[model samples]
Target: MGINKERSAWEKVNMARAQERPSAKQYIDRIFDNFMEFHGDRNFGDDPAIIGGIAQLDGRSVTVIAQQKGENTKDNIFRNFGCPHPEGYRKALRLMLQAEKFGRPVICFVDTQGAYCGIGAEERGQGEAIARNLVTMMNLKTPIISVVIGQGGSGGALALAVADEVWMLENSVYSILSPEGFASILWKDASRAQEAADIMKLTAEDLLSLKVIDRVIMEPNGGAHKNIDAMATILKDRFISTLEKLCSLEEDKLLMKRYEKFRKIGYYKE
Candidate 1:
């Protein structure tokens, strides 16, 4: 009968407004010039959850994939708050493949709670779709870079994150599973989610220390939402620098580094 603090925190952070928050799309529009959007997976219906397009970052051509959360009730239903269904990931895969075919570098903005787990999504093979994206991304020929702008949970996040260099905002989270889900499975009580979150090591700082992420992009003092323009500028600079470094590498060397990067993710010795 009392208030649930964990649920409150989860909702407060997760349900924060797309308009109020400094979103990835806003940054892309303001910072990147000559942007052009592409649509649909071609095999299925178009998904508003994932937005992919071509953009010029400091005058260099690049492909951008962003997980878009909606601004209002109707748009929320459309974008699904950045939670991609199977088709959405497929759409992303199509764009990534396009970028590779054209030898264009890819930039991904990740901001998803997880892949859509609805009955419809399952029927459409959401898990298979995510797995396929991971496999294809691992072997992608063109340079790939990812930025975790907000919630990057489970396979939804992983699909876009198989990049040569990964960056995470200071306050963003990346995890294999949500804390509530983890607590439900591990402790048999969802009320212990806070404890699970502490154990999961989902924070950007923790991942950076573990080498799960290549770098941490600092947000404004209050948060990214407070100073959107400043945050966008910082990200723009980092993206330019990272892409330049990746572009300098030969395909074979870049692929080798990417392979090694993922290989070291869970490596430990006692």
Candidate 2:
């Protein structure tokens, strides 16, 4: 509530990085039922960073895709610190296209510092993969919703975030680049990350005020990890209600609205 409001952008970034902050997997486990996780990109190897599958939201079929982070060091290494590769994005797109064919809603949970930037990832067409998703998801027929549950950075996060409506957790951040990266590039000093975070306006409250996000799912006093059940409940309620409205729209209207939603972003002049 007011806790999120009182925090500076840098404070929100720290909260987002907290080891206790609930991961996408935790939310999926709590909010959905009968989740059947699928594997592989069918082009390259499977990625543990991106998880996708068919699931039931309430009693309705839906596609759940999320960028997963580990709670500890060992798991983080296994999960690539939540930085997905080209194959991960490809795998997610495969599931999303399937969801469209089946007329199922798609729910995306975005939580990554950014996409993997290693040489191997680039050689695998990471930019192309992310670009493909952005274009395809923009026109996807099914109702789509994306939630920034933690760090939503760069094109990696945007690939899954072209939805009818995008939301964010109270302490999560959405930005073109991580604050440290932004500082390093702009000020030649990564230590100015705190100032860069403020300038980037990556915090949920900032994004909401800028109309970059439709809603901010308020966290409990201690934060989301401290009360994951409560956070899941809040998120589930929103998913159900929003999907109901989105699903009721005619196919053409749904696509049109989704198009307009994004087209209207960045309309302001300095």
Candidate 3:
């Protein structure tokens, strides 16, 4: 409960990346039932980093997509530390379009360092994959709700984050880039990541104040890692309520509003 005081953006970033914090897999397990995972990008092999499939949330059918982070060193290597590759984005898009065909709402949980930047990834069209998703999701017929459950960074996260409603966990951080990356690029010193975090305004509270996110889901004291069950419960309720609201809107109206929601972002007046 000591988090009674406001936390700095850097502190929030650290908390979001804490080893004990709940990851997308844990949340999905608790919040959804009977998840059937689908693999492969159809064009390439499967990627463990970005997982997508069909699931039931509170008796309603939905398509769930999430970036999975590992809990241990071995698992991290297997999941690529949740940095998705081009194939991962392609797989997600395939599943999302499938969901749209069946009128199923899409739920995406974002927790990634960014798209994989390895030479292999670029060779496979990482940027093109993400850009394609951004374009397709803008007009998807069904509703979408993106939740930043942890460290949401760069275009990798944005590729799956276009939605009618975007939400962030209290301690999660979403930004154009990770603090270390920003520090290295701007100051030529990655060790000054703390300073970059402060300047980035990446915390959930900051984004909420800036109107970049629709809502901030409260995490248990000390962060979501402290109480996985409670955190999942809150997220489940929010998902149900939001899906219910979105289900009532006509397809055209939903798409129009989603367009407006994004178009209005970053607009400011002095």
Candidate 4:
């Protein structure tokens, strides 16, 4: 899609949350082959919101992990609106560790509003689950690539996002919290979400400028949903190129680079 330079951050946020936007399931179906879905955390029930499996990408085995959001009401309810519980994070961690064991790269598609804050999820240790993933991912021996395919909100998104290379779709967004939440916390009015988005620097381009993401994948003129075939092709190419580059690095170097990458993320003027 032709880059719309005039689009504001708030506009990009809306686009990222568009109901017609492509979900993680769609990306898996289009970009990979021989996907064998593995279910459950082996401690609790499987979480539909976090889908993890082994898939073949360009004839190479890779672990595919993503947060799945439903397009319709029925599906959304079934998937908990893509808000994962503690079990979902645990499931993702299991797959990542398994990928490392087998010497396969881990590819993550991040799209979530954050971990579920329900009492049950809290009782199950949601914070601990995400925290574990963050620390473990930092030290993983295999290459990790994370793509923000849609709305990436808070720690739920970050749990899957710690990677050697983090990419975001041109119209996607990644932020510490949702615009509505930011508005509520800052202005005591959720209606100022548009205003909050303006100043939040959460858009893909904005994040890239801030060095928050390594790259940006351009979508179709309107959006990825507008041209799935073209979008998928570009995404596939980008993934392959990135994977090839990361694969060339030694495991220790990869881990060190990943650690250093995140260590330099924030601004501190001397």
Candidate 2 Cα deviation (angstroms), residue 66: 0.3
Q: State in Å the error of residue 36, model 1.
A: 1.2
In order of appearance, the predictions have TM-scores of 0.90, 0.96, 0.96, 0.96
Candidate No. with top lDDT: 2
Q: Could you give candidate 3's per-residue lDDT for residues 66-158 as a string of tens digits? A: 999998889889999999999999999999999999999999999998999999999999999999999999999999999999999989999
Q: List per-candidate RMSD values in Å.
A: 5.5, 2.9, 2.9, 2.9
Residue 164, candidate 4: Cα error in Å is 0.5
Tens digits of per-residue lDDT, candidate 2, 1-270, equal: 353567889999999988888999999999999999999999998999999999999899999999999889999999999999999999999999999999999999999999999999999999999999999999998999999999999999999999988999998999999999999999999999999998898988788888888888888877898889999999999999999988998998888777777888442222
User: What lDDT does model 4 reach?
Assistant: 0.91
Q: What digit string (tens of lDDT, one per residue) describes model 4 on residues 1-270?
A: 445678898889988888899999998999999999999999988999999999999999999999999979999999999999999999999999999999999999999978899999999999999999999999999999999999999999999999988999999999999999999999999999999999999988888888989888888888899988888888889889889988998877787788778999442222
What is the alpha-carbon RMSD of candidate 1 to the true structure?
A: 5.5
User: What clash count goes with each model?
Assistant: 0, 0, 0, 2
- The CA lDDT of each predicted structure is 0.83, 0.92, 0.91, 0.91
Q: Across residues 1-270, which tens digit of lDDT does each residue of candidate 1 receive? A: 212223333433353323566667788897788888888888878888999899889889899998888766788788987799999999999999999999899999998889889999999899999999999999999999999888888889999999999988877788988888999999899998877877787777778888999888877766678888889999989988888988988898788888888998442212
Indicate the TM-score of model 4.
0.96
Candidate 3 TM-score, true structure as reference? 0.96
